[model samples]
Target: MKSNLLSLEMMNGQERLHEALEMRGFLVKKEGPFLMLASGSSKRDLRSLKMLLNKLHIPIFWNGDRFQLLTNKFPVMMMKKITEHRGEEFPVSMEGYHFRWRAFVNRKNGLKVDALDLDPHIACFVKAVNEAGIPCLAGCDGHLKHAPNLQFSGVYSGAWFQIIQEQYLSEFELNYTWNVEFKGGSGSRLVASKARNERWDRHKIYEDTLKMAYKLKEHADEIKKRKASSFKRNAGMKEEAEGLRTDGRFEELVDWMERLSN
Candidate 1:
């Protein structure tokens, strides 16, 4: 029973990741959702591999990636002990958890950032494991800008990897692909849109925001005159207003507006 007989099921949006690994000489066998890695694959420096994958915008499947590193015997025994497997490590819902959005400034660079609320379940699990004398630790998953770095508290240096500077398509670029789809009984017409300079789009967005702000101000006045409505309407209005106010380039937009007024 060598550890090489491990199988990991790759989820959706992970095909490119699998291909990337294979291209790198990893002995990976894709059998449906499961990916079987050769022996000694896990013992290698996984963080380095994760760092490369992060540059490609592919994250390891929640717990599946970590669990594959364990010996088959140990994983099997743990699975039997837990009995309630499947959804324990990750949420079962196809849809993601509805985490509350937050806005704050990054302490390191003083840049305004948006993030989601922390998962309480993770804390509870860590406490439970520690109380059971399992010596469990909590750390970052090293996704995207974060390195695949994981360390114990005693020896942890909370350093993140430098952002990889490469000409790659981001989520914003992918938005143009949404209108690109195959028609029924017709050959797919894959048309790549002409790339425009980002500055052009940024200028347009700033102008649109100024126009929207005026419209929202008018709507806010109208709402005041109307009868009281549900909290949903109020919350929607508040969120949009806050988003515009907190935009990182908002100060520059204000200057543009002032110049236009002159």
Candidate 2:
């Protein structure tokens, strides 16, 4: 593994430090109040960078987004000295295509867990599914060499099945085609189909997948709204029945009770 320690030592400011780290294959970005670092695709680089940070006495912690430098751990003067330099802030938009972070709650202990950064292409889809109340178990962007896919849990419900079927059949002929495979009790997988040996159109797939994600979210929201409306109507009827009973209107109470049963 290559080390950026020597070059970092020679760096006078944050700009220089950022450049040195980048040259050593680390992705450096500003996230909120902290500087964040990622190793991109290299485990060796990540290990080397972690070692260098430890040697420098910089406290870092993984915060779902990236390894964030704990600037507060240092004295104010020392922190200012080390972090004083400015350059263009890292782009916050998807144009940069950095991996996305997600936080999951551990069911066993109910503790918040940080998930590994997701591939940029499929991250939004995963987020959409999750926000729509379906659990996304895994996803792959296919690295442009195969079909990108997402694995989901609890997709056997009638509503989800219908939505998946509609999307799968409707998007079949598109450049970024979609397929849904049901695994019975195991849940379902949504695949962005690509022919063997055909490189995926990453940008196209990203755009198409996002559209599909929006559609799924819309359907999920509609279902939730319908359920809520049904529940509210039922509760209102029950309240009306109780009011009728309390008012000694036996005929009205019976009619309300019969309506509720039906």
TM-score of each: 0.19, 0.39
RMSD of each predicted structure: 22.3, 17.4
Q: lDDT per residue, candidate 1, 1-262, as tens digits?
A: 0112333332222443343243232334465555554332333425534544444343345344541222222233222222211111221221111111121101111111100111211222222212222112231222222211111111000100000001011213222221211221111111222235422232232222223222322243232222122112245544643454345333343333233223
Off by over 4 Å in 1: 1-13, 31-36, 66-262
**Candidate 2 root-mean-square deviation in Å:** 17.4
Error of 2 at 222 (Å): 2.0
Question: What stretches of model 2 exceed 4 Å from their correct place?
Answer: 1-116, 154-173, 184-186, 217-220, 226-262
List model 2 lDDT by residue over 1-262, tens digit each: 0122344345444444444343222345566744565322234435545666676676567655456544423343443323221212121221111110111111111111111244555654554454444445556677777778766542222224335445433753456666656442324567766667677786677566556555554565554333233223344554664465345454454344334323
Total backbone collisions for each predicted model? 1, 0
Q: lDDT of each model, Cα atoms only?
A: 0.25, 0.45
lDDT of 2 at 151: 65
